[model samples]
Target chain A: MMEQPNRGRANIVGNGSVGGGAYTSVRIVGEGEVLGALGCDTFTCTGNCTVFGPVRAGLFKQRGDVTVKGEWSGGHLKTLGQLTIEGSVRAAKLDIVGQLTAREFVETDNLKLQGAIEVNGLVNADQADIRLYGPSRVNEIGGGRIHVRLSRLTAMKEWLKPRHSTELSAALIEGDDIHLEHTRADIVRGNRIHIGAGCVIGRVEYSQSLHVARSAKIGEEVQL
Target chain B: MEQELISKKDLLEQMDISYGQLYRWKRKRLIPEEWFIRKSTFTGQETFFPKPLIIARIGHILQFKDDLSLDELAGTLSPLQTDIRIGAEELRMRGLVSEQMILRHAGLALDSGQLPFDQAFYLYVAEHMSQLLRGEITEQETGALVRLLRGQLPKLEGKLCELVALRTESGSSMVLHTGGGRLYADERTTIAASIHLDEAIEAFKKKLYAY
Candidate 1:
């Protein structure tokens, strides 16, 4: 299934819509849309693109805005601009430099984000390195090695506009090694948890060790 | 009918496992999403799991972590993804079901190219029931059980159901219904033997796909 050979290539040089099917490569140079499910080897989009159905590609790279009405699943996904998915996402590797809004869950093996993310459902990843530049919100986040902090550039921008807060808010966060900064959460549970500066946590539960910054506000702390 | 539940706090403490491992297994889909039951408590919100099922699953994972990868463990542990088809010769060779029993059961011909999942399941359950109720049930009851399962299993796919054998002075009959609740029998009949369908399926898959 991983080897897709001898399939036709779909190319949209201008604004157009292509019916989704198995393809060796799908390249959209300008605005385009996919009508149905697509299974391709590689999908690349330079301008905006919309996929009405699900997509399963080997390597997916998008530079401009992209919206997936259905689920998006692939081996490697790297996006530069804004990305929105109405359904869930399952990718082995996800790298996003801009904003991401997912109405459902997002599961990946490795997630590297430089901007903000809004997920209505849980975000589960094995290794998550999120540098929030804007406000982010998620229902829950769980994984193995989770690191979240406000980017240095965002901190400089927030210093001038102190009223606006660019923090990551989650209802529940559970993992093994967790380091959080400027994160608001209802509950945080992990083995080794470090609550960095500018965090408001309702509760903190740790098994091994816990370090809370003086600037962070915590309602309760329990070591189990 | 309510199932016995263990909270997230107690489960981690009792299992001596970290939250990372639990959530990691969940992400890998080794644990079904429906098992995580959330409810409001005085503290705000709490997550719970069906006590016995979670314990058994975690124990299984711990025992096999050294040998099998998570993907392989998921293939054997996940109940909702049971789509295994075995040939008649392999089934007979594996001795999953007795030869005489397969011969007696309908739609279980030895020469059938491939035995569908449902047929193989029915035969497995019938054989299990006969062994469980050796003295209580007769060959005719086994046939009846197979028929009852064949008609009801499709409708209750991916759900936890039960196969019950009821006997009275008149005769014996079988019934299939969703599990986790008590079944009431009138004054005439008594419940002979009841088998949880999901548990049976899990056990069957473990036997078939185990390395």
Candidate 2:
């Protein structure tokens, strides 16, 4: 049998110029297919797949999905599309566009996203989280509503314990109103913060108001 | 290698810019983290800073962050100087400058520290401060807050509590540790807190969040 060359098939490579709104098909490694080059306008991962080198996409805008049944490390992953996984999500730094629902911890310094972040462990968003889950440790350039599920948390510079007294990080939280669910530190000093019930902060230093809860617990002297 | 000594007030002053500017820029949507220094000595005091470029960076943020909000000014600002926002009243009684300025700023905004326990405003102050600045006098600012509270409940149990600070303005400052809102004291108000003692003396330190 002679080789029949199929025409009209476009092979998109790294240097190839694909038109806008293009849909590229990618084959998963099911029956032992080590897909070396991962380039696409739309990408998806199923079962166990491994990238020998690095994987780059158009920030999920090109539509890339990684179930990551195996291990995905090194480099960066930017998804303008939605990413949903129930596996161990680990990375040096990750930036996503869609929602991030991980069953593990997230440690990144630069993440500018427009989707919600729902993780089980600590979430450290260096920039902003349009939506969030659980307690976080971050150095924010802006302030957003923080939901800390843990009893207590701190940062190298600042934290979102917007209660009576929390620790400091070195960034500023500018919300006319902030809420510290509970307090349990040594000394808390800064600007204006509105605290709530069941808190146990330690050193209650400088701040704005001192709205105490009925069932709240306090330490020693409160200097206002 | 040895680093220079950077004062706490100057460092806080530098952060004041971004914290202030971001508030206006984002319109209460975002705020940056505070600047923190490592507590080298015991008593949770004695911080270390690279004095050469510290104040200059903080001054940069303070200079520019007057109206920039959190989302608008992320990498563009920082707290390098040490100008704390304490009044003259706080400077006199709790006059421990070199030891605990970070602890003083933990309430309102953010402070650059490692621990979060210091962030908790010991419940009493944090809760009250949270409710006080609501533009009205609720049940929160009426009874429990006006007087010094002492109880035998679990709230007062466990650790040995002490409220010793490292940052003071001069002798007086209007510093208030409201529940956990913003931390700002007028002239009569002095920023102070009570703590349950722990083995780690560094836990006693304060971190500056806002100005």
Candidate 3:
């Protein structure tokens, strides 16, 4: 079903779709799509949904596949399934499970990612905890505290997808305190940094302390 | 009067700044286009800058580049209009300037209570107080400084210009020129303290433009 611009609240059940418009609260059950900009107070999608334009919401929760083609900003965003954002995302708190892909920067106060993730631009947060499941790639990651570790399901997924590697590849990773495992980067800078096993890095610049696992490969380490 | 010009090569060598940094700053409008004077020499076409102005500008940029982002530094170097307000007590506590002197020189009545100062008034106080702290200045000089600042601050609003300082060969005096006006200070004066103006204005702009 297709509807015009909605102002107050909207609920799309089953395979219903809405056109570009503003809504106070939007709830999409089953498969639904929004063709244009979406401004809402709360957005909840239980199934598959696609937003083609910028989305501004106070609260956004998705339990299934979701895709946003433009910039997105919200107070809180929680996703349980595959979430893909083509543009930047700014949120107060971001908690994701399953799989996530953001083509541009992701700025948040706190971020917790379980499963696989890919970001083409920087990921800046106050605190970030990432558990990598499959091939994950981020151009840059900066925050106050960051921890990245591979999940136990990596081997199972590796067997399922032999073409994709289970390692994380990043150009730069910077933070005040950083710990990484099964990751590869060109440069890593922080006040305290620890590179765990199965990691390869070009350079490590740390201020206070640095620890490199015996299995990690690093080209140079500098204390500043 | 013939302006003294420094070759691009000489300026880069003297300032110890890279060519990339200079071009980047130029692209950002931190340095004026007219400052880049092109002339044919034995080698080929060469660019030049007014020696005194370029030196001062480069020094200022280098000093503050670490504290402020390039965009913020560009804002500082440019004479962008700003509306900065501060309470009298807050100013005093911050030690940005001497409140007593502000009252005496800028003619701000202390008994008028703790009213906030506008941008021009605030900058005037900051400029003079920085000078006053460097050393002793005659009452006449203080009044003249205040008058000069008052006259210049308003005109600088909404314009794009840079503050440039030229130190004398003897290193005993310096001339600060900005927005077509000049102020001379002796060795006892501290020019670095004036960096507060850049910081203050940047903070104000951040607050004003925060969505």
Candidate 1 per-residue lDDT, tens place, B87-203, comes to 665556666787777778845433454565567778888888877777567778788888888777776766778888888998888888785799999989999898898888878
- Residue B128 lDDT in model 1? 84
What is the per-residue lDDT of model 3 for residues B1-211, given as tens digits with 9 covering 90 to 100? 2456898757766897644466456645687656777687653345678775677678888988999987788877555422123345544445445666566664652334443334334444444444634644445545655565556655656543333323344332222244544455667654432323454555643332222
Q: What is the TM-score of chain B alone in each candidate?
A: 0.57, 0.24, 0.43
lDDT of 2 by residue, B106-206 (tens): 33433342222222223323333333333232343322332232222224333344332212444211122223344455565555433223322232123
- Runs of candidate 2 exceeding 4 Å displacement: A1-177, A182-189, A220-224, B7-10, B18-37, B40-48, B60-211
TM-score sort, best first: 1, 3, 2
The stretch of ten residues in a row with the least summed lDDT in candidate 3 chain A is: A1-10
In model 1, the clashing pairs are none
The numbered model that scores best in DockQ is 1
- Global lDDT of each candidate: 0.84, 0.36, 0.71
Per-model TM values vs. the true structure = 0.72, 0.33, 0.53
Q: What TM-score does candidate 2 get on C-alpha atoms?
A: 0.33
DockQ of each: 0.43, 0.04, 0.03
**Could you give the candidate ranking by DockQ, starting with the highest?**
1, 2, 3
- Name the best candidate (by lDDT): 1
For candidate 2, the per-residue lDDT at A2 reads: 18
lDDT of 3 at A64: 93
Model 3, range A7-124, lDDT digits (tens) per residue?
A: 7778899998887777878999999999898988899999999998998889999999999999888789999999999898888899999888998988777889988889998787
**Which residue segments of model 3 deviate by more than 4 Å?**
A1-6, A155-164, B1-211
